[model samples]
Target: MSVHSLNRLIELREREVERLNVEVANKRAVGDRYRRSLERMTALCEGSGASAALPPALSLNCGNYKQAMLGMVDLHRQDLALHEADMAVSQRALDAAARKQEVFQQLLARRQAQLLREHESREQKRQDELATQVWWRGQR
Candidate 1:
């Protein structure tokens, strides 16, 4: 491809890579939040056992509290699972985008190098022709 076309393609690929990076970051943040939420749920469950020293009136709701905690923990677990799946997919997508960009960069570099070599070859040929003309003139 022409250098101009190659440059445009590289630019497009760069933009795609940047966008994918942002998406990956966002996914990571979401996953982190879900992980923290799960951790908090676990801590709460652990701490609930220590609440047994409460007054009799307050202790009466222990069973209900435990049941509710169990439900919340289950919900958190489900959410964490879904988040993990999403993170995996996003990570794969990011890797693909990065690879594509790398390919474009390599292609662009090769094209630029080829152009430079061609330019040098043409300049060398021109110089040789000039030298031959000078020699012919001196011989005359």
Candidate 2:
């Protein structure tokens, strides 16, 4: 493949990797927030009041709160599962992109080597021409 095409592919692959990284970070953040919220609910229900275990207001909305808290916990589980699945897929894509990047690097190195050899060949031809001219000038 041409160096220009290879370079463009590399650039695209790098952008994809970066985008995936950001996506993974966002998924993790959402998962963490849900987990923390669940923890907070648990802590609040089990209160810090040494004698009264439940928060004063906690009893007022007992049945509704229990159902709501159960719903929240269920939603949290679903959210966690969704994020985990996303993370797995993203990791696989990133790994594939990394492999492609490695291959592109190798191809670039090979192309550079070929160009370097071509440049040296051209430089040698120029030097030989200069030397021939100098020898002819001396004879003249």
Candidate 3:
């Protein structure tokens, strides 16, 4: 096809690749945060269990312990939400990248076909010129 259309396709592919990279990075970050939240929850459970063995007065700030656990629960929910959002974004990016990759493959095929045609045309013209030169020399 035309150069302009090819260039546009290339630009689209580049943009899609960029967007995909961003999304992958974001998903990775979200996964990391979710894992950390899980770790935090485990740590909180362990801490509470350990503190339960102590006397009430010294059981790891008894008055505020419930509130702290509640906060952790809230964070756990938020982390889950972030993870889901990240997954959706990652899926979209993957889809877009796949589409762009297909377009790139099509562009490559078109270029290859054009090159083959040009090569054959040049070879045919070269042979014709050589044949004409030989015939003219023979005539002379």
lDDT of 2 by residue, 32-89 (tens): 8878988987676445334335566664566466667667777877877887888889
In model 3, what lDDT does residue 139 have?
A: 100
Indicate the TM-score of model 3: 0.66
TM-scores for all predictions: 0.87, 0.71, 0.66
Q: What is the lDDT for 11 in model 3?
A: 77
Candidate 3 global CA lDDT score: 0.77
Tens digit of lDDT per residue, candidate 3, span 39-82?
Answer: 78767755665566678886757536756776777788787887
| RMSD after CA superposition, every candidate | 2.2, 4.3, 3.6
Identify the superior model by TM-score, candidate 2 or candidate 3. 2
* Candidate 2 vs. true structure, TM-score: 0.71
Off by over 4 Å in 1: 50-60
Candidate topping lDDT: 1
Ranking by lDDT: 1, 2, 3
Q: What is the C-alpha lDDT of each candidate?
A: 0.84, 0.80, 0.77
| Superior candidate under TM-score, 1 versus 2 | 1
